[model samples]
Target: MLPNRSLSRKLKIQSLCSNHKQQSSLCASFSASFSSSSRCRGYDDTIPNLKIGKHTRVIFQGFTGKQATANAKESLEWGTNIVGGVKPGATGEHLGLPVLPSVRSAMEQLKPDATGIYVAAHQATAAIEEAIEAEVPLIVAVAEHLPLHDMMRIHSILSTQSKSRLVGANAPGIISAIGKCRIGFQPLPTFSPGHIGIVAKSGTLSYETVGSLTRAGLGQSLCIGMGGDVIAGTNFVDALKVFETDEDTEAIIIVGELGGTAEEEAAEWITEYKRRTKNPKPIAAVIGGFQAAPGRVMGHAGAWTGLGEGTSESKYRALENAGVTMVDHPAKFGSVMKDILAKSGSNFKKMEQSLAQQRRSFHSSSSPLRPQASRSTPLNTRQQRSLHLSVEQNATILKNYNINTSPEPDQLPKSTHFVGITVARSARSPCIIAAPTANPHQLPHRVRRYPFDYRSGPSQSAIKSALQHLQLDSAPVSSKAAIVKLINSLWTMYKEKEAITATVSLALSSENDDLIIYDSDLLFDDAAFKSCKRQQDIHSLRNLTLLAPTDLEAEAAGIMYIPLETPASLKKDGKEPRNLIGTLVNGAGLAMNTNDVLTLRLLKNPQSAYPPTTSANFLDTGGKATASTISTSFKLLLSDPRVSVVFVNIFGGLTLCDMIAEGIILAFKEVGVDKPVVVRLRGTNEEAGRRVLEQAKLPIRAFDEFEEAVREVGRLASGVEAKTGVTEEGDLDEVLV
Candidate 1:
């Protein structure tokens, strides 16, 4: 049995008994105050059944756009109650639905309960503002690549008196299978009506997990894709509160990944909820990016893991400590849930048996699962070419920002002890970390970390308190003063430069107890570089040679690309390197899951003729991509001499498959492909895209089934028949049983 199963029930009974004793002694005035103050109407309000249902009225902000029109048609066909849409400066009907000029107009005429914004990234802020201005209950912004500052401003607005609940700036949206309501672009065939509730940071991972649940006969009640950005409007705790009150939702699944403390926060909430309830719902989580390297940003803007508790291991431990079942892999989520349910007692066992029967009956039919896809003056030029600054360069830059820096090497006194200090942005706030070491590469376990308010900055008193806590109070007064001044300077630099992290090495001199800066490393926010002129001036110091050529090319081509393995890492002393399968995916989650499934298949068959297989790179063309962008992505992949095959997996929502197909054809004509190319297209405009690919007569193998496409890609990469056979019905009886 799971750890929290009966324990939760017992605790709930005790809580009830305790509450009964207190109820008689409660005063009438206290009860009235609690009732009125507890339920304020806001984003975090605990409104029961807040999940979109069959009767929830929805509207679109970009009603007249190609993406919006196509999505609206699908929603209407799927039985979503889309009353109308808002298209500024446009009128009349689109897809047989009334189109107004603005969100306010639609609110007046249609009284929509929710609004899905399908505009471009640059226009998303205005769209969200309009929806909030109209007080739309639920607002879903499906645009990706939104500026970080823009999201910051939007978050500020949301923190005010607004009544709207914003979903995604780059989210896949929400879907309620039981109600037949779809607010965003979720693969319809993979979903079924059942009791499980899912909240995920990645849309593609949510789709993959949902497919597994449905295959196990545990269909979803509601699936929410909390957008993957640095600052999201709705977070894990917000969704968990909603799920706790949803009567249809009996169990919960959280799909988290590397970067951010959302999972840890969720764990904290679950622990509190267990203490308060008798029979709290069981939760199971599958966190991605176990293989992710530290300090590497994997696809999502918010998925980068620096030092501290943002790693996947930390997240797993936190959730496990909270008594939540931690799944090892995304594919294993369903089976783990089944095991939990079976151990939940007779009632849950019966429900599990009923779901198993449903799975058998459903697989017996022919329905197919859908596929899911600053610089100073002269230094300005030098800064543009360098990724990080040298100690001298950093000192110079800091001084220009009104920050203090240690004197030059020749001016420093004889050193006796070395220490390290780092100031970086953490999940909730900016934190300062200090250690008594000179080795910059090694982070000691016994370091002191202090978190302070970003707005107020770190004060001298706070620095002294940290030093005292670390037992460094006996250090020379001059040395302590120097450390304080340096840290204050670093905090100022961190804020003004819009840096992700700023680190420095300090040497404490024996003479007069002085401190000198030995080395420094600074990592600025890339978003700030693009959005702020000041940051751009600082970016001029970037060294082009420091970054991967393919990354630079991808940036120029307007696509997101992250190299999984370098050619040098793949080579042995005297053996041919492993074949690299380059993936072209549209969503960050899908790209990651594709890599996971492919790696699993390769590992399952290790003795293949084509050597071990692995994804060479993770590429996302984004939701609002064009044919030219797709062509550019293919060209970039082909440019890599190590790539043996290219896998194009797309689940068209805002991105139409026809455009993707057209891009492949364009790449064939322009760059000339020599490697094996495998393509899988699903979602909006899939049929048209497939037709275009077939008509092009290019040397591309296209498949309607995701698993088949994956298998073919594996076979092409490994010169042998791919193993781990999965049926079109997703028959995982072996694993599930």
Candidate 2:
């Protein structure tokens, strides 16, 4: 909103979305003074365990409160030194924890070493003040919405005069599970006691990371959620320091995203930590919202930007250059860490066996992460970019235009015909996977198969006949192809997929469904919203296979529910690992059927808003034909484990090559990375994308090729690739190159 473009406007805080709404910028105000030569990263590692004060205790100021009570009880269950609570009038009474009228009283009696402040944002100032007065050396503020100025002032006071450590204003707190103490609301069930440490921005991502690590049979020395707000109290470097000191913590996972220089700062600290620490722990990372445009903010209130390092792609790349290994998907991050730790010299199978048990228990109908409350957000712009980026070291530099960040991206015709196929028999499915003959709708078709609360098989003839009734059963028969083309011009396939995913994600929040993506009460359910969300996650194609429209005119069809088996099926002897590693990411495909090459030109970069290298990909894919091209591209892309991601950007233009089904399989077989390959094949030749993938015997994850891929890609990438090893400087500059 500023008149002078160069004169940046200070960002203001916006309310966190209670429901699925368009995301706003992540920028906000904060006061910071960085000493360019300062090496704060090593400082955490050097804080010897014996050097700190003793008798650590926690004071949940809002102890009797809802979240506070739950977290407090859980903390107590985990052996946290919850000394007491403070209620203005009820001074000398006790509930679960002891009751103290004031911190002064608690301080005089307990003489605690560390304190965690669990109070509302409005009360944070007073709580912090009390902690300071009592001289608590460590403070983790577990609340959101503390005004920027208040945080600035509080931080200033805490940093200058106090010995206390202010961890967060909106954080989920920390856990040293094995040490028999914790400070926040980490579901005790998911946290097994072990050696890995975590530092993350989003709570969901943190939980998922823990889940992944647990699945890999690893336990956490401490899994910390720094929170997603911009002004979190603790930085990545701070958490790393804790990991460095914990004897149980053998390695660390530093989760980051685009927007803010925390990762870069952490990178700088790594150099110093390497020099200072005799035994350095391995680190890994996973960053999200890579599709976000430069200058576009995503999460956190205090996570403001000054130029570079504030984007997802850049942050992850920076972490990688810092020598972290890529976990690829959020669900697999622990594996990456395990591998690094093994390389760094540790018990790999012990971790793997533990993980096997965890995975075995995945989706035990009783677990929380079910799809019942599991939201269906459309593919976001960030996810979309993650799909298409050929080599994304800096995800923020992704092709923004490729993503479908809209709730209304899905706009199907009031009465439209689609080109679909009726599958008679197959090793996998007995049902049908129909797609738009011409991909005019630019939508994706996804069928989620969770370990628990899965869908029963829908009738088949009912589905096959639905397509036949519309005279759309056969492929390539486009009656209103022109009209479809026109409609596509007005909307992108990715956007349409987003709309559908959003609509369904919101609509299917049936109270009966126990799908719980987050432990908190954040669920999105709205028909229109779901449609829009679905549209974004997809490009252009409906999973006519699963959506059996019950038209009386349609015949009865039978489907055999596909099992959600782990890839590379493991044996009793444990020699074979799981195969078919499929994940959901921002939907965008790799090299197009049209453009053969897309060079980042890292050496001779352009200074234009539309970089020539990237622009060429768009121009080429928007053009023309071929059958083998689709599969060949996938094969080429999948060959490199580093090129683990495969994106399908479906505009109504060139990428609509006549047959892409085969491409999905070739990439799976040839690429052999077994990583995630997000597909968004829309526009002209979308049917081809579907037909080929459906034909292969390989177990590949095929969805409606639309924006659904984009949003899904984000979810898939949210928790993996935690920071690892050491990092090298200067590779981040290669994004523009």
lDDT of each: 0.67, 0.41
Candidate 2 ranges beyond 4 A from true positions: 1-55, 275-279, 293-296, 303-309, 348-357, 361-737
Q: Deviation in angstroms for 409 in model 1?
A: 6.5
Instruction: Write down the TM-score for model 2.
Output: 0.45
Work out how many backbone clashes candidate 2 has. 154
Q: Once model 1 is optimally superposed onto the true structure by TM-score, how far is the C-alpha of residue 568 displaced, in angstroms? A: 9.2
Cα lDDT over the full model 2: 0.41
Q: What would the per-residue lDDT of candidate 1 be over residues 1-737, giving only the tens digit for each residue?
A: 11232443343343334323322233233334222233233334423324889879999988888878878888898889998888898889987789898888898899888899988776888789777767788888877667554564454344433256877767888889889889888877667887789999888778767866766767789888887876677778878998998987888999887666578778878998999999898999877665443345667877764433335656777788899987544445566777787776415533342444324212221211111110011101111212466667677787775545564466443332233233322223455666555442343233445554354566454566456644457877777777777777777777766665676666655565555665566766666555334477668877677777877877787687876654343468855455778889887767766665565454333432345666777787876689899988988888766678999988775678899999999988888888889998866577899999999888898876565576677677765543444466654212211
Q: What lDDT, from 0 to 1, does candidate 1 have?
A: 0.67
The candidate scoring highest on lDDT is 1
* Estimated TM-score for each candidate: 0.73, 0.45
